[model samples]
Target: MRLSVAVCVPLALANWLLFSLSTMWADLEPRDLQFQSPLAWLALWANLLGIALLLAVLWRFGLEILEALAAAIKQLFAREVDWPAWFAELYAGLRPLPLFTLPAAALWGAWLVLFYFFDHPGGYATDVAFQIAAHALGACVYLPIFYRWRVLTKASSHDPQISG
Candidate 1:
């Protein structure tokens, strides 16, 4: 249950952030997405790659939080009376939950795409970056759900009833 909550909180917050950003993106007008030339396709591919990199960074951050929790869990299993000081502080302060930042970043990334993609009534069309940003936006929204699922999975793994 504890592990589940730890995972779920971040996921929920990330989703909330996604929702917020999606809301803003929905407000913007869609501009031309020129797939006319090879250059355009190349640009699109580059942007998508960049978004993929951003996702990787987010993954690493999530891994850090989980690793911290796993260390605390190992101590629990060893019958240690207390967690390490830094993690103990986290547990005590319930600061292990970094639910908000991850998702918000995703949303902001999408917003940047949308903001940059859309053009004025008689202006330039969408950039590859904007399209990539929009795709990134979708990816970010899912992070929270993935985190929530991870929480549930870990909680089930450590079920005391089964252990006993």
Candidate 2:
């Protein structure tokens, strides 16, 4: 069960990326396009690199993810555990790292600017909106599981007094 939660992160990310990319690609045509500036290209690459690095890190630390998921699940269902504090700890622990933060900010800033300036066609606007929502949802689903794993491992190894 823990392993499944850990595995779901990458799987969900991959699915979201694939769906978003394919939809955006299909929306574009061979013509009727304007060339982007070098700065735009840099921003695009930076966002991509940042996301790839985030995913790589998560995948590499699969065991920790599993541990977190298990711990979270235990705390969530156990009436004796303070579920609110568990959530607070989870949020504090999973606060965005620089690797994820800068790139994510760049991506978000770019999207906001694009939405403000450009007039999207057909259901393009809706598609983009859904993509953004999907990204948020993915984070919502992954963070708690990851945080639980981190806290559980930390408590077991270094803080034996801590309990669920």
TM-score of each: 0.29, 0.31
lDDT of 1 by residue, 1-164 (tens): 24433443444444444444444344555573234567755655665565556555545565576556556555554332223432433343334234443454555544444554443222334445445665664555445444544443465467643221
- Model 1 stretches with alpha carbons more than 4 Å out: 1-33, 65-83, 90-164
RMSD to true structure for each model, in Å: 14.2, 12.1
Superposition error at 136 for model 2 (Å):
5.6
Q: For candidate 2, what's the RMSD?
A: 12.1
In model 1, state the lDDT of residue 57: 54
Clashing pairs in 1: 10-99, 11-144
Q: Judge candidate 1 against the unseen true structure and give its global Cα lDDT, from 0 to 1.
A: 0.46
Backbone N/Cα/C clashes per model: 2, 3
Candidate 2: tens digits of C-alpha lDDT, residues 1-164: 23333444454455445434443444567584333566755655566677767666666774477457756576665434444545565555445333344444445444444543353333586657747865875576567656675665456455544444
Best by TM-score: 2
